[model samples]
Target: MAWGPQSTPDYRFGRSKNTQRYSAPPGVTLLGYASPEGAGDAIHHYLRDHEAQVRRGQQVVRAVQQLINQGITPDITVTHPAWGEALFLKTLLPKAHHIQYCEFYYQNQGADIDFDPEYPSSIDGHYRSLCRNATQLLSLTQTDACISPTQWQCSRYPIEYQHKIKVVHEGVNTLFLTHKHWPTKSLRCSIILLILLTWAKRHAKRLLNASTSKPLPYPSGLI
Candidate 1:
């Protein structure tokens, strides 16, 4: 089942069987109450940020409860914990094994904070980032297992949760990886060369990190 915005056609078309999509309630406000601004409002802003997540989490919990009452019990529930939907699932379905997709963890340095000097960091950015991770931390605690698309992504999580995360690629699009009959030989060769180059870089990075104390290189934000 998919639980997200109804505006996306993919979910509407892909929804099958008794699976359902539980989206946000109408006119609930995008991020809870009105957001606070300016330096003086930093603390207040972060409070609202967390409040928004809790509100969304409540909605998810209610939706799941309704589904459970309908006899639609699942043995395994796969969810992305980024938005707090997976927070209270374990409370309702203690017997069900929950596997959360660990997408990204916010960091103040060397990762998505001051990546570009042009876009300088905000004064309360660090605090906001930490508050943003509250939902993730809660969801991870409730989840039985976790999966990360890359090793680097898994490493971004807390040391406690890191042990539970398994690194696994979701798989690539074969159509994009392989050439079609329409493409010329030269184009196909170039594409293959690009792919090989990317693989070589990743391989080199793995070796370098393994031999040194430095960690595997990851993008400033989500890898």
Candidate 2:
């Protein structure tokens, strides 16, 4: 069974709303929660109420346990950020393989500078601590695989976890790239060419209409 953060109705960044619409692989079931829009508020709330975080985590764990209790033995349990930490702590799926998506790091790295404006230092610290905890837990757990979009993030993980981590570079959907060989052209290049062609056609039509508006003066014999 598939156990992970299913998509919600909201248009949250990096998460698609149609996540649950699709069917899962055989013997797999998708799980999800009604999540808030941004991490900032959630992080702030968790910091102020540590017990609340634990309670929230417990709820998630119970949900997964319920699935297992119902004879749905999922082959894998996948998770992101906070949910991943909660699942790791609960150890509910001792038999199932654990897979996590390493989305980002909260440390004071250069990349975090812009984000600091939205997530203050306090929130950043809390997030970092949580991430570190999650990383350690994942390291100890017998997870089958760790998926990451970037090689840099794959490198940030501990050497032990690194071995299990796989770098699956994100790619466009095959359906969208109908031209099998067009992958050679970057998405930006395709978009630019389309825009240029559209503009040229539009302007060419305008020019044609303008020229036709008035019969060319003179040229008596040229119809």
Candidate 3:
């Protein structure tokens, strides 16, 4: 069951059959403090924007509480903590195992914010980035486990938190990558050669028996 913003998924994008959303009251703005004028203003805007996150967290907490009141307790809770939805879930469900998706950890200097030479980050920009990471940092501390899609991404987080984070690929679409019904005979000779090279290397024992010294049927030059 999804607990998020109250809106129907556009079929153009696709939709989940089951979702439980908690929308903010009308007129509430999404939390954002990206572009601030000065450090002081940055802090002020950051705090103001965070208030919205707090509200969202409260909404989710209330929803979870209601679910518990109705005798529904999830065994495991998975969440993408990049936003604040996972903020207070542990508080409500102490026994549940929470696995947070650690998509990114913002670093002002060595990361994306400053990588663009033409658009160097300003002092205020750096402050805003730090503020943006506040919720994610808090969520990390609360999560029972964290999954990062790559080692490079997991490395971006603090050393202390790395122990709780595991590097695991979200996975690729095998249907698109390997499930296509392509005719091996119809494939170009070059394409066929590449596949055979991989197949021979993987199945060397089967390809190279005591009867032959060579492991592959194709010429070494082609491979």
Candidate 4:
């Protein structure tokens, strides 16, 4: 879904590449910005995170504006709000339908903050976690709809926004997720796996993974 949108049925995505120089694929266009550090994000403060997101949103706005200037206006846009790209989008393209790729939402309790028995959530910690969600809430408010990977995750958003979220699995890797039978001796042992869904809980809420970092361009509506 990252690179599937196009007027010509081609896939294109873009973002900051390694400083060592890079090359794009045969049919892909690199329509992104090379942010200073952590895509202009910092882990030191919550306000900085929102600023970083705004910076990214500015990059996206410039890219889209350029496209419009060239007679290519997008009818639909998909973005990840964890980094703040979606914050200023609706103002620029109010007519374009925006869809946010919903993921993990941060909360003081009933979530990962207190999931660990070793570290209990504190008032300060809760406040920080809540602060982390500022950009997400703003993005959610402006977005026309949302899509999450699972029902449980989709339910993480505020009750008023739940109606706009849709459950759409990106699909699992059958090669690693296929069912298999284990011997009785092997079953005796316990296996605990920890999966990090989004960077909200990590990096002080300044998400910097490929999913959030790379903002691709699409040609038109829901294509």
Give the winner by lDDT: 4
Per-model clash counts, in order, read: 1, 3, 0, 0
Candidate 4's C-alpha runs over 4 A off are 1-6, 9-13, 18-28, 36-44, 173-195, 199-223
Sort by TM-score, top down from the best: 4, 1, 3, 2
Candidate 4: clashing pairs of residues: none
What C-alpha lDDT do the candidate models reach, one value each?
Answer: 0.61, 0.49, 0.61, 0.67
- Give per-model TM-scores: 0.61, 0.49, 0.59, 0.70
Runs in model 1 with CA error above 4 Å?
1-43, 173-182, 186-223
Off by over 4 Å in 2: 1-54, 84-86, 114-142, 173-223
Q: Which ten-residue region of model 4 has the weakest summed lDDT?
A: 214-223
Residue-level lDDT of model 2, residues 69-138, one tens digit each, is 8665555555564333334432666666666676554344433323334334565565655544443353
- Cand. 4 Cα-lDDT: 0.67
Model 2 lDDT, full chain set:
0.49
Q: State which candidate, 1 or 2, has the greater lDDT.
A: 1
